[model samples]
Target: MPDKITIGGVSVDTRHWIGGQRVASAETFSDSSPIDGGTLGEIARGGPAEADAAVAAARDAFPAWAATPRAERARILHAIADGVEKRIEDLAIVETTDNGALLRSHRRGVMPRVAHNFRFFADWLLSLEHEDFDTRGHRNHVSWDPAGPCVLITPWNAPLMLATWKVAPALAAGNTVVLKPAEWSPLTASLLADIAAAAGLPAGVLNVVQGYGAEIGDALTSHPDVRRISFTGSVPTAKHIAASAAANLTPLSLELGGKSPLLVFADADLDLAVDLAVEQYDNAGQVCLAATRILVEDTIAEEFTRRFVDKATTLRQGDPRDEATDIGPNIHARQLEKIDGFVQRALEAGARAVTGGHRGDGQYYAPTLLTDVAQDSEIVQEEVFGPVLTLQTFTTEDEAVALANGTRFGLAATLATGDPERAERVTARLVAGTVWVNCFFVRDLQAPFGGSRLSGVGREGGTWSFDFYCDLKNTVTAPNGFTDHG
Candidate 1:
């Protein structure tokens, strides 16, 4: 491999990292930047052969790495965190250029959080307490065992942060990793692999295989040696992976799509509600946890609509590298077309676009809010995953709960109200795995995080993350007085 390759006017090193070395693929795919639809460069396109090699490398290194002391593993993790912080500016630029998210958001939030994911998991590993029980003069000790090779399939929207969300836990639990990054946002994962190796991570402990998910995902998921799988994507993709892993009985932790709701009560703080409403336009409305379905109490619906439309229309959309840009272009032309289709169909069906409704220059899409929408319109019920919000008015608490829980998805929901009793009441009735009252995306690393219904399969955070990454084994010691001889 060359010392560096030119990508969109920047010299960067992005290649498949296998067995602690950079390996190029026989075939390549063009990765286009959404900023101007310019060709970034030809990315390494891995197939079954590359997938097999990565799995082999991870398998070969698992035994020694798993047996390594936890303290040493944690030290290396902190070192990785250090490397991430040192290169925060570089990673933020690459990620913004690769995925079209605002560079300011990445530098201020995403990159810093990426470092936090590593350091938090590392410290948590050290502070963990194993379960110990003594019953009837017998001792029962529960321990965590590394589950061998793991396959981590991450999404494109927030590439490095989400990949490390799984990578950090899997490595801390002593499992070797084979990461399959989204084709659209593959750059930062390669950077992470380099960071890990520089942090004294042993060879083959972490490998990256990049390509289209359709070709490479099957081989990685179906591989017999892979003991664990953690995926974050659409529900249909999760079902396909489940079938592939079923033969090997490989456990999976799937974090799927969402059509989350944000219920605005009549008594809610109007400014707070409108601010939260405008935040859906952040990242071009690509976040899965975004509450795109807005269920508002009819009493304050008129004033709420006016404030929401004003703020959303003013959101800046331009070059992601600009600090002033609040919203960036959609990830690609394909995504932009999809966002348009959803908004257009809704308008044609008598729904009114309160703010934005058309595609802007190039891949940029105008932030949109739709009112007078049918409760069961395809746009209302489906996951558009774009900068479009649907409005529905309800008068009663029961109607709000029903409207929020009416969809098939239950990933997350938001409630804005001052009454603590009502917040608790509505929160209890919302079926989403995570319910945010008076805020959005406020997270604690230790909290149980995942989706309900079609949103996802298993919880991942705190011990839940370790539970998926490691095998829990319970040891029971027999009482000395009643030891039986076989």
Candidate 2:
């Protein structure tokens, strides 16, 4: 709600964060509150020109930033983390208002995780290793180098967190970035730019742009100066970015969609299973790794469904700002419509709505649970991305694994079982980037986060994130003799 958001110690004139400054163009878009459909503010609608300016700024900053020592760069990132910690309440307010995430969750769960991610990556930057390899009289050494200019495209669901997954690492790895935040929720992204600017990141090193994907995203993807693209969004967009990057052979890292499943075994704790199911659906199942499908062992399927439905039915569905509310609205009206269409299609295809299957308004869809969902049904296969949970029964472990891995997405899977051996075995067999044994939806910054197959291309968190943002340069030194010109 500030008149002008500050970034890099500079007060930008525009509402939206773009080109490393506040940007106000003739074109503008209104940011609306999903909870009550209230207008938040009008943000600048950046197109190709803004995208070009952002990319140019990043290109200009890359040389000097990349040349800066790792320790100094790490210090800047650390300062950003400190700023985030200081303004946690303000950032949380903006994020919750814009994205419809629970205020408590944004403050306690999401913001803390983001802070940890930045700090963890900052530590990794200080400890990064470049080894000297000596192989049979060949003195070879390898050093990590920045990837130059990077284009970061983030989604609207977790606007700030997901964007930081790319921005923090790219910046810490010494690559200047042009960040294109999803237009629907640009508040946190803009606020982040303000925080980064206040933390003393060089102007061009971190830039934010707002616009439709076709214009700004296309420009960022096709720009000759951008050496890498890191995106977190739907599979279709990922495919587009991947293809565009392929044309120029620019390196890319994508964390796409997922229809992740949770397998509950006969020996599992039913209470705990129900608890996790409710928790995973807390953000209305908008999270990428949300346990949308639950494949339970036949012996416990009936009881699990009975209890799960009861717990889900008890969830409070209303405004995100309400402390008593357990679930909130979807990010937008179109998202609610999309979710409704999926639910209706599933019902038409003989799926039984075990519980809620209705929409309250343009943004709020009732927390829903569907049973008897066909294996090939769109609701089961595609990413509904709403508070809709589908159930299927499996007789054996093999069947459970098959059902869990049935979808093209392999983002995450959860196994709830008391048997340690079975948990380990099922964890290995489940084809997902992150597997939760006896739990679901829990993660740490130290853990490497990403998915496999159509889920994504590269890891996002931990030390491995540097791999996506930096390239390796190998050098060889002769003991005393000369080197070959070739």
Top candidate when judged by TM-score against the true structure: 1
Model 2: what TM-score? 0.95
Runs of candidate 1 exceeding 4 Å displacement: 1-3, 7-10, 481-486
Worst 10 residues of 2 by lDDT: 5-14
Write candidate 2's Cα lDDT for 266-315 as tens digits.
89899998887777786878989999998888888889988988888778
Poorest lDDT segment (10 consecutive residues) of candidate 1: 1-10
TM-scores for all predictions: 0.97, 0.95
lDDT of each: 0.91, 0.84
Residue-level lDDT of model 1, residues 1-486, one tens digit each, is: 353556545466657999999888888887888999997777888999999999999999999999988999999999999999998988888889899999998899999999999998998888776868898878999888999999999999999999999999999999999999999888888889888889899999999989987788999999999999999998999999999999999999999999999999988999999999888878899999999999899999999998987787778889999888889989988888888998999999999988889889999988888988888899998998788898999999999999999989999999999899999999999999899999999988899999999999999998889988999998888777565787
